[model samples]
Target: MSSPVSVFTPEESRAIKQSWKALTADGLLPVGLLLFERFFADVPQVRHMFSGTGIHGDENSPKENFSMETLRENDKFTKHAEGVAAKLSCLVDNLDNTPAVMNICSELGQAHKMYNVKPEYFDRLGGVLLDVLQAAMDVGLDHPTIQAWKKAYEVIAGATKPYL
Candidate 1:
């Protein structure tokens, strides 16, 4: 079977690199936190997982174990998000390095699978994250930027397909 990485085009790869530069130049770490807050808000049960708690099947918890304060200015959360962004930036920088990129994608996919994250959840998270990036870049949905993000997400989704 063709790997998910096969879906990306050269142009798409370039766009991802440009977008990553834009995001980091504008402080993506904080913006990432905001994006994740909204993304997990919809999946309340997932909050604990990000908080270092293992995922539990039940979804009826009334109170979230972690608060925004726990995430804000938290070194661990900051480091984690920064690591993810860094990995993503590396993927963009080495877009032509298919082997390395594919490996990272596969690892991410497996991690998501362990978290029981669904494809739809990824879709939603992607949308929100892109929105955060767009706002951070202070650019509307320009064609090139959006296309790059689309390609990036496609690659990630493809990587995560095994887990899903």
Candidate 2:
């Protein structure tokens, strides 16, 4: 039966591990930049999620927007991505404990619900992340590698959705 997330085959897991190793050497900044770029481009409303002020009221700046240029220069963006990479690495490193890691993702996602994060953002992020991974790695990442990331994203997103 089809599910929100599927268990990766041993081969797929191996491919994902190799791809992630290359990505680690390259750093997560590029990946982070791509994430914010696609996020802002596809769902501009999410910009307020990371800003200094809330989405409404005079305290909010109407000019506030997400930009690839800005994301590059933004330390917060880089740092946030680094943290994400670290956590994701932790999860991937311990794929043997899939259920535990997934629980962490669900808890984290639920915690963000206080910030008014929507399930759709998780969906959007999953798709854009896959696009970024596939695009950035080019020929180094074959179809099976891409599929591994896709499966991983689905698990993360699916676990997150219930709390949102």
Candidate 3:
């Protein structure tokens, strides 16, 4: 199906690609995890829903086990978070492939809908991510880069809006 959102402008796409590359080069996988950390920090109750498994802290610790109970209780939020992370990673990796990017965005949006993820959460996620990026880079996002990131995410969000 055709995407509901317009394709990103060439400049926006380049900016996003550069940012993703810079992030990965800096040793962060899926930069979205930074946002997830912030999101969970703000919503502590959501942490209980997440099995500590597949998530790591700065210090060494045994992996927390996953359980169906956690899934059943917070499946929507957890699944959407996981899906968004995966989709963003895929987009970064397949940067040259428009179809792949669109597919990931569509699937991400659909997953969010199934998980009942709120639209407002997307904005929060983007905001937290930008904050994380700035901190990680030790500098604020330049205007052009910020605009590109916002534009790219907006396209992703708009494409996925139908599923939500």
Which model scores highest in lDDT? 2
1 versus 2: better lDDT goes to: 2
lDDT of model 1, residue 34 = 72
Ranking by lDDT: 2, 1, 3
Task: For model 1, state the Cα shift of residue 96 in Å.
Answer: 2.5
The residue pairs in collision within model 2 are: none
Q: Cα deviation in Å at residue 131, candidate 2?
A: 0.5
At residue 52, candidate 3 shows an lDDT of 36
lDDT of each: 0.67, 0.71, 0.60
Residue by residue across 9-125, what tens digits does model 2's lDDT show?
778778777777777776766656667678788888887777642223244535245455656666776777676677667767755456776787878787788989889888898
Model 1 pairs in collision: none
Regions of candidate 1 where Cα sits further than 4 Å from its true position = 1-10, 26-28, 42-45, 53-66
In every candidate, how many clashes are there?
Answer: 0, 0, 0
lDDT for residue 111 in candidate 3, whole number 0-100: 64
Q: Candidate 3, after superposition: displacement of residue 131 in Å?
A: 1.7
| CA RMSD of each candidate after superposition | 5.1, 5.2, 7.7
lDDT of 1: 0.67
